[model samples]
Target: MRLAPLDGGEDAETKPLWQRLGWMVAIWLVSVTALGAVAYLLRLWLA
Candidate 1:
């Protein structure tokens, strides 16, 4: 059987390197901010 690309398709490869990196950084920032907010709220609840 054949396997699909990890990124879902060729669209990710078609984009420029900087654009891809920018998207990754943006996603990482959003994820970190969300986790931090959750942790802060949990701390407030437990304290």
Candidate 2:
């Protein structure tokens, strides 16, 4: 089962450094925020 299909058209290396880094940072922030929210909810439920 393939989770992500490989696209033959777009080249990753062609993207600018800022755009690549921006996506990385954005994904990281979103993941962290989601984790924190889940942890808070779990704490409240356990308390």
Candidate 2 has its poorest 10 consecutive residues by lDDT at: 1-10
Q: Which candidate number maximizes TM-score?
A: 2
Q: Across residues 1-47, which tens digit of lDDT does each residue of candidate 1 receive?
A: 65766556678779999999999999999999999999999999999
Best by lDDT: 1
Q: Tell me the deviation in Å of residue 14 in model 2.
A: 0.7
lDDT tens string, model 2, 1-47? 64455663367888998999999999999999999999999999999
* Candidate 2: RMSD to truth: 4.8
Clashes of each: 0, 0
Error of 2 at 21 (Å): 0.3
